[model samples]
Target: MTEPLVVEFEVDAPRGHAFDTWTARCGLWWPKSHTVSGDPAAITFQPRPGGRIFERAADGTEHDWGEVLDWEPPGRLRYLWHLFFDRSEATEVEITFTEQGGRTLVRIEQTGWDRLGEAGPPRRDKTRQAWTAIGEQFRRACQ
Candidate 1:
């Protein structure tokens, strides 16, 4: 099993606000390049355990992104991340928001890459880059 890939950063927003934006307003900040449909018309996270996280295309087609595993407002969220659109090959992701002074510290950790078998490492590398870019967009939105 490979070590989980962790990404951490701070957003210039209150912890509660940052958490709300990340879960409730994901579509506003999620980049097109990171979407399954490439050009999603809408994206949503159901914000509770067992809720759906999905994206809808202009054609009204909805693609499954993941299922919420754990939901704790303003603190943590855990979910299965199926970026390939296949739950059978899904990985786990956990995001936490911590208040520091007046800003929010956001941390994301993704694991279970070994489930991808031999394709894990390369996929992890690519996803690391994608997450880095996506984080930048999230930072902008939080501002």
Candidate 2:
């Protein structure tokens, strides 16, 4: 089995507020172009346990992209990512928001990847880069 890919960042925002912003309104900060549909406007996340992280296309198509495994407001969220290209391959992701003074310390830990084989490393690296970029974008958006 492949090891997990972890990524973290500290944002200049309150932990509670940051957590709300990330889960309650992911589309606002998530890069829509990064989605499978390649449409940013379609991205959506429901910030509740058993909720969905999905996309709604112009054609009125709602494509489920992930499932919320755990939802604790202003603290942490764990989800299952079942991407389209490989429906059999699933992964778990957890994002935590910790308060430090006034800033929010965000940490994203992802694991449960064993299906990609030699492609796993590259995929993990890609996820790391993508999450890093997304975190940066979120910071900029909140600025």
Candidate 3:
């Protein structure tokens, strides 16, 4: 097994605002390049454990991305991220929000690639790239 991928973003917003940018306002900054549809009507999180993180098509089709495992607002979120994979192939993603001098530090830690066997490393690499780009967009949006 390999180490979990960790990526961090420093945003110029309060903890609550930063967290909300990732959760409530994600649709505002989520890029088409990172979406399943390439052009989704919306990206949504259900705001609680067991709630779905998904995308909706213009025609109202819901594409499942993951299930929220932990949903502590302004501080933490953990979820099972399947994205294009089956639920059996899902990986875990944990995110934390910490405040420093009024700025919020958002950390994303993705694990469980071992379950994917050979496909694990490449997928991790790709997700890491995606998150890196997304983090920049998120950071700008938080501004």
Q: Highest TM-score among the candidates is held by which one?
A: 3
Of models 1 and 3, which has the larger lDDT? 3
lDDT of 2 at 137: 86
Winner on TM-score between 1 and 3 is 3
Could you give candidate 3's per-residue lDDT for residues 25-127 as a string of tens digits? 8888998877788889999999999999999989899999999999999899999999878999999999999999999999999999999999999999998
lDDT of 2: 0.80
Residue-level lDDT for 24 in candidate 3: 86
- Highest-scoring model, lDDT: 3
Tens digits of per-residue lDDT for model 2 on 80-112? 887664545668899899999999889899987
Position 137, candidate 1: lDDT: 93
Where model 2 places Cα greater than 4 Å from the true spot, the runs are none
TM-score of 2: 0.88
Q: What is the lDDT of residue 8 in candidate 2?
A: 83
Worst 10 residues of 1 by lDDT: 82-91
The order of the candidates by lDDT, greatest first, is: 3, 1, 2
Q: Kindly provide the TM-score of model 3 when superposed on the true structure, using C-alpha atoms.
A: 0.96
Q: TM-score for all predictions?
A: 0.95, 0.88, 0.96
Ranking by TM-score: 3, 1, 2
